[model samples]
Target: MKEPYEKPLIKKVQVGLSNKFGSVYGRHLRPEIDGVPISDLVSRFGSPLFVFSERRLREKYRQIYQMFSTRYPNVQFSWSYKTNYLDAICAILHQEGETAEVVSEFEYEKARRLGVPGSEIIFNGPYKPLSALKTAVQEGAIINIDHFDEIYDLEEIAEELGQPIKVGIRLNMDTGISPQWTRFGFNLESGQALDAAKRLVSGGKLILNGLHCHLGTFLLEPRAYAKAIEKMVDFAYELEDNFDLKIEYLDIGGGFPSRNRLKGIYLSPEVAVPPLEDFAEAICDTLLSKLKPNDFPKLILETGRAIVDEAGFLITTVHASKRLPDGTRSYVVDAGVNILFTAFWYNFKIELEEDISGPAEPCVIYGPLCMNIDVVAENVQLPPLPRGTRLIFSPVGAYNVTQWMQFIRYRPAVVLVGEDGQVDVIREAENLNDVVDRERLPERLILKKS
Candidate 1:
């Protein structure tokens, strides 16, 4: 009989390195995740699994929180729910003391169901319906107005409730980034932001207590934060001086990038993506200089990707291999864009779980999807991988789960690797019932058995 449990295997992988004497070369294998063997995890949880390290999750939150708090007084972080709202992920962050920052009604409800109070939630996004607004308002969530219509909508709500509502207005500005995110909020450079603020405060039914702006995502340049903070702080002071508004918080919304390299970037991720420390310095120095030393507004970071991306992993199995007409190697894996959606934007670092000895060759990695557009990586370096071989993808903790779709196949199970090496399944692998459960059929359309 086959063994009931698979023993941990020590595998070797080629890696480049230098010795202390100045010349050395060898192989390095990341054989396990938090000491849990990849094969063991697969055997227990099924294939195409997502693994999050609890230790890493806590480390990232503590790192970003410490970096900001030690530099500035009264720093708050709201976990961006749109990134990876898996209950396990959110619960861990909530345990670390992060409030929820949701963009939609579903996400808001998810946060509340997770035991986060309404007052602690930061409600944002452009598509909040009237019903959601009423719920958010009644629950005391920090509502950030996205468009001019939202102002009118909230004014009506305040009148209905017979109370003036406290709110924040989302602003968009050019922080020296390309194709400026002009679509989301009022533009600061065009004076539209100022006009909107004026209209809100003058309405008498709404109180503007906070300022918010989210520069685009995957931000590589740390200076963009400096520019955003400088502009927001100046505006906060102007509002205080002209309208006597007391700005309680300045939400420099999150766009902090992860280590994942984007396609077509000439520079490597290390050269392209600045460290978190650099971002903290850029943001804090500006806030420390621009605001009053004694009464600085609370600094709120609505960060998402940065906190969770590096803590996630996706383990997949290679089922088939082929050579393109052009002679490039191609391999198809069990997980596809339907599951690993970020594969479209990032060239993830892939590691082999089994020992494969050969010279590395340029290759293409494709998903199991039938669509031609389901390519994962254009051209990557990997040794020949046989059937049943496992590949581990790192830093996929951000938006994959939230954005992933249940297309041609059932979505995979997601598990959390605890600090003590205990593996717990957070999401189960989908079954046929899971796929058809929400679907309905008409009586006339139901076909009778032959």
Candidate 2:
């Protein structure tokens, strides 16, 4: 026998949810099962923490490598140290067989510390201190000399060391780009590059092994690279004809764009602004069509941004929400311009990790910095979020890490999420003692305290 039961009525609640960035999880961002949510990660590591996705990093790196290797036979990527320079990140790249590209003395030492052999490192920059030149020469690193001053300095250093150092000259070709060839390297059109090469060969103090040209960074047009490659090949031929020197490599400096959208420009993901395939095709086709089989030099790329941009994410907490005088909503977060310099140049897409029953609203995102210029996003469409809600900014893995300044506020710790989904703190958050360690107390100010 069974007892009789009564049914109870249940009420349903209406919720409003919308996808702002068109995240992969359909219309709503959800908490990743293993990657951890913005809120949970913040609760554990505090706000304004940087989280790196190992999956994304490896994927991007492989894509870049394949793009060039499939098209050209001899292709190598020298990871630009100035882009990120995190030992963990560089270690990952080096483990994947990528070489190191260093600019300064400190970065050269860092590369050496990372166990990157001097033969694998390519030293490129305009200003290399004498000490750096000496170390590079001793280690057999390929030194990319920038100007006449550098040439003289290196010649003197080589003479003093009693050994000829292998060097390359950075050629600045006029590709008719914006802001027009103002910094670094000798100009090709002005015959400065030719003159410099001739002088170096005639002086016999240094060995000229290659030609380097970095047209510009974040180059949007593939044709610019094609033109630059054509010019470089011609220069290589001229060097061979007159100086009887066989150039060993052609270093095409890195400026590849990431997936982030530039400010004031709206582009769909499918549009493909100078896709990786296009760059490979242009560079390979130009080199293959221009140079002979024996003249084929090792194609070296110093890419930083494109390799690591998609790997980084910044998770922050909403400090407050307010309405402007004109009826606009604004959300202030705990992170700011001190860490995210790319916000000035990129329209960083921000998204919520949970479903919310609120209408979408236009808002300005502000950081916790005291300066008025600490805004992260202006006129961004985001779902209505309450205080303490978490927001995630994507595609910030490149310049932000190296360029971030500890201005007005201390920077946050950086964590590298391993491929196995384990989080490791690569850099710890700065503290008062960390800053004070570099500061010395004046003897006059050191008085006995009562």
lDDT of each: 0.89, 0.83
lDDT of candidate 1 over 1-450, digit per residue (tens): 563443443344333444332322332355699999998999998889999999999999999999999999889999999999999999999999999999999999999999999999999999999999999999999999999999999999999999999999899998889978888989999999999989997899999999999998998889999999999999988998999899999999999999888877746577778999999999999888887769778899989999999999999889888777667779999989998999989988788786688766667989999999998877566776777888898789999999999899889999999998988989888899987888999999999999
| Prediction 2 TM-score vs. true | 0.91
Top candidate (TM-score): 1
Once fitted onto the true fold, the runs of candidate 1 whose alpha carbons sit more than 4 angstroms away are 1-28
User: Which ten-residue region of model 2 has the weakest summed lDDT?
Assistant: 6-15
- What is the C-alpha lDDT profile of model 2 across 1-450, one tens digit per residue? 563342332323222433444322223463552466566667767878888877788888999899889878889899999999999999999988899999998899999998999989999888898888888888888889899999899999989999888899998887767755548888899999999998899889988989898877777878878888999999988988998888999998988888788875665444535687888888989888998865568999999998998888888889888767666678889889899988898877676777766546567999988889998998676666877887778879988989889888889988887888788889899998877888988999998999
Candidate achieving the largest lDDT = 1
Angstrom error of the Cα, residue 427, model 1: value is 0.7
CA shift of 301, model 1, Å: 0.3
